[model samples]
Target: MSSSLEVVIAGGGSPGHVYPGLAIADALRARLPNVSILFAGTGRPLERHLVRAAGYNHMALPAKPAPHNPLEAVRFITDNALGFMAAAWMLREQHTSLVIGLGGYASASTVRAAVGRGIPTVLLEQNATTGRTTKWLSGMVESVCTGFKEVTPYLSPVAEVVHTGTPARPRFLKQYQQWQQQGEVVRRSREPRIVVLGGSGGAQTLNKHMPDVVSRLSEELKDWRVVHQTGEGQLQCTEDRYPSDTSQILTVSYIDELASLLFETDIVVCRAGGTTLAELALAGVPAVVVPFPDASENHQMANAEVYREAGACVVVDEWAAGDRLTDELTSKIRELAADHQRREDMSRAMRGLAHPDAADAIASRCCEILCGTDMRVAA
Candidate 1:
């Protein structure tokens, strides 16, 4: 393989899309030390921060989400056209060997540009119900790597579907390994913790309801504590929701190092984004998943259903719960917290579903497509 091989990872309307791409890039670098990796995406501050923090060059594109109404149609076309042209030029100028698409609106143009340029391309679909971008680009790409095997039927048959699972960051994988070795000793020394993750953008429903749910379990959770990551801008509001006896609950705007936090977590109450689910599985934390109703194609719910079927999580539909959201969440958390055996079973099930080597698997696949040989052995 050439030492100057360049790979552009295109994705990132949200952290869910970006993190997987970063994991893949990390894996690629490990397998091919000289490989150049670039991220192409919208100029969202969050996206830029994450990529730059991971020590990668990012190229901002004029990509916009697909229009929801007729009024947005023209702007969406104009922006994406510019993005497509920019992506095409980037691929040619960088002499890109492979273009990996992590599905989102931001990735559509770049992957399309790669196909137009006849470049080796792979799409990563991180949901049981594949996103629209992945479905549209499936037939054009060389392969569609999926987080869930259930997503295969949604993709085009012309594309090779590889179940690589969701790629978690290296730190999470390392922590998972360490936990496997000494988790029992460590866990026994610490108080049981229930973590509430509202994602990078705080879920309003979770932020409003979780504190109350935790408070309801005060007696049952006498020995336990709750740590809530309320995302940015909602810290004060979420913090205020807790009772005067705040010893049992801690609310923060964000968690800078979630992998470390998960190392000590006994249970998690979070939304069912593919990346979050993958992380929870890796940490082997029993989860009470609340799927975002507004997720693209209800993909979060679909992702949650897979885990629920495997006995890895308890799924709660916030939309369906309506006024009873607090009641339902309290019930689930109460059940999980009280049943030590059940939590252990769920944790085991979660670990059983984890793909610890997902990043490497995806990296190997990309290399095989590029070099026509197994790069794992070559590396």
Candidate 2:
């Protein structure tokens, strides 16, 4: 690859989509000192902040999620057309050599523009099932890199399908090494910590139900420290509900020190987003994954199932409520927290599932394509 290679990494909607692109961009930068990355995304405030904070140029597109209502659907179409135009102009203006779609509606326009211009395009699908945009563009792209092996069979027969696993940020690897160094001292501690993650945007069901679950198991969890990463939307309400006297329960709108949090956590209760799962695997943390039922094609459930099969985590549906939810979740957490060996076993299983070098692997492939190695993925 050229030292001055320029590429557009496109995706948004949530931190799940954006972070992986950032990770890949970082990997590429590390590999090629002069590589330039321009992040293309919808003008989401969070996405904008994340990209700029990471020290990358960002191009905002007029893309939006597909709307259900007929009127809104028309707007979506028009917005995407404008988005395609914007992306085309960016590619030409920036002299981008490659376009990478990170699996979201925002990436669709950029990928289409690149392909239309006969420029190279690659897609990173960070789920067990292919995202709608990725699936639609599969046949036209140079390659489709997947987070799970299950995705390979579902992709276009002609497209190159590479199982690169999800690209976890370098922070996870750094924290994992630190945890390993202090593993004995930390594991020997009888009091276990539990961290609840509601994804980047937060999960409403988790926000509404977790406080009660904690309250009901307060006695059992008395010796345990619990930290809940409530999304910004539920921050104030969720915080007010916790008892002021107990230092055992802490609630925050977001998690800034996620790697450290995961390093100390014995059990994680979170949504089954690809990026979240990858971090958990890297940290070797046991989890109770609650799949978002409305997620496209119920992909989260499929993602969780992969971990459950490998003994990495337990899966609980979001719809489970009251006693059904509380009883099952409490039992699962209690069993793991009480039994050090069992948590350790789950941790080993999780580490086995992780691909710590996935970002580098994808970056290497991108370099191969850019440097004019056969663009077609090897069979």
Candidate 3:
């Protein structure tokens, strides 16, 4: 890979999408010192801050929000067409050798423009099932990358699909090492420290279920120290309902120190987002995953199933609620706590499922696709 080469990355809106882009961009620059990255996305606050923090040249385009109604979809399409034109202009201006679409407003335009100009294009689908955008654009791209093993069936036959795991923040490896050194700190009760999150934005489903969760936490949970990461708009409600001094609960809208908490945590209850799954695998924290039911193609459930198969996590359907949910968590945590070997086995199995060098793998593959070099994926 040539250091002087330029790569344009499209798709970066939320933390779910933006962080992975940053991870890959960092790896690409490290491997190819002369390589440069340009991120093009809508004016998402998360995208703006993260991209600049990564020190990449970014071009922000105005984009329409995700649409639910037919009229909204039409408006979004019309607005996106204009965004695409701006992205095309950026693509031409940057003279990118490789275009990477990460399945967001920006990627749809930038990647398409690169393809239209006969430039090599690569797309990364960070889910067990391809989304509407990825599924449609996959046929036009040079290759498609994924994090899970279950996506092969959905990929286009003509598309060169690579199972390149999405890279997690390097900090998790450090957290895992520290936790292993500390060993297990036994609590008086059987309940484990359960952390709940719904990607960066948090989930209304998870938030709504929080009241039930707090009120019905198993008796064993009394001794457990619980930390819940409820996304914005749900924090105040979660805090008000579940007082920390009253219960073993610490609820926050977000945690900047996620790496530290992940290391200390014994169990996680979260939406089965690709980035979250990757982080959990790296942290070696067994989880009870509740996938976002409406996620495109139900990929979150598919992702959860993959980990569950490896004995890394348990999947609880969104439909299962109230006492059913509480009982499930209690039973699962006790099962793990009662069996030391089970916990150890799960930790090792989960670690095996992680690819810490996923960013490096993606960067290497992108280089291989563009420069005809052997891209190295770190083990």
Candidate 4:
């Protein structure tokens, strides 16, 4: 083990990318008592706030998303150039030995700089499909740590691929187990509960359509309770959209403690983000996964398909919302709500996919890399 270990984890656009880095940092701390890890984020407000809340040292990078238009494309090149220069200077100033990229446009600069300077680098790909940033950096990084085995086929042939299932924080595991211990009491309750999440920042489409979904199910859900997380500025709209006198529904802008909410939830209607999916699997909560259609390469759909194929979830396309989507969603929800055996079966399947030791596994490999051990996963 290196007496001096310093790692810079760069990535951020959402909690999905950031949390995995934090989990790896947590795992690193456990294995290397003196390991020093810092988060290098995109300087986005959400990323800074989350990194601060996690109580880790953070440095922001002036990184921007790859541009779609010509005007923005010029800006993208300039920003990447500047971000890369800044990252290179930071690595030298901080005496960083390893740089780990979690995924996102924000991660591009630091990873590019690290590889350019010949610093060992690794990337953690969270989706079943390769993210754009991961794909761009695949040929340069020393190793590509993936969350799904399905992703291996898509990565660069020369890259060292390690299948390290996404890490779910230990708190989720502990809280879920406690809830399971009280399962009999929970099952005895006549009231049914479901949670609607649109990612950490909230999903506008889900917020727009959820009230309708609940209204149609209101009569059948007379004994039900709902927790809806509407993204900022949309909470009031969600509240207004709910059917009049809907005492069964609780709508909020965001939830800081989702593990607690999942404790009482029967089913989850949410986006199929990698981190969210990992939490759902750990909690063994059946879900109605609505992948964000615009996700790069439709990775969320690929992620949802993993569980859908395993019979652990129901996948609903975002495009189907205008057509029979609501009807489809309503029917699925009704069926799951009514069929206790089916939900239990789905729960079992979800649990079967959980990798509780994912963080430890990835950490061991990270330590191995730091010690100049084999970085490649055995064939």
TM-score of each: 0.96, 0.93, 0.88, 0.93
> What TM-score does prediction 2 earn?
0.93
Estimate, for each residue in 88-145, the C-alpha lDDT of model 3 and write its tens digit. 7877777778888877555677777788888888888888787666666788888888
Instruction: Please give the CA lDDT of all the candidate structures.
Output: 0.89, 0.84, 0.76, 0.83
User: Model 4, range 259-278, lDDT digits (tens) per residue?
Assistant: 86775677999998888898
Off by over 4 Å in 3: 1-4, 176-192, 320-341, 374-379
17: Cα error in model 4, Å? 1.3
- Residues 4-83, candidate 1: write the lDDT tens digits: 88899998978988999999998888778888899999869999999999999999999988688988999999999999
Q: Point to the candidate with the largest lDDT.
A: 1
| Candidate 1, lDDT over the whole model | 0.89
Q: What is the lDDT of residue 262 in candidate 1?
A: 87
lDDT sort, best first: 1, 2, 4, 3
lDDT of 4 at 68: 80
At residue 132, candidate 1 shows an lDDT of 54
Off by over 4 Å in 1: 374-379
Cand. 3 TM to true fold: 0.88
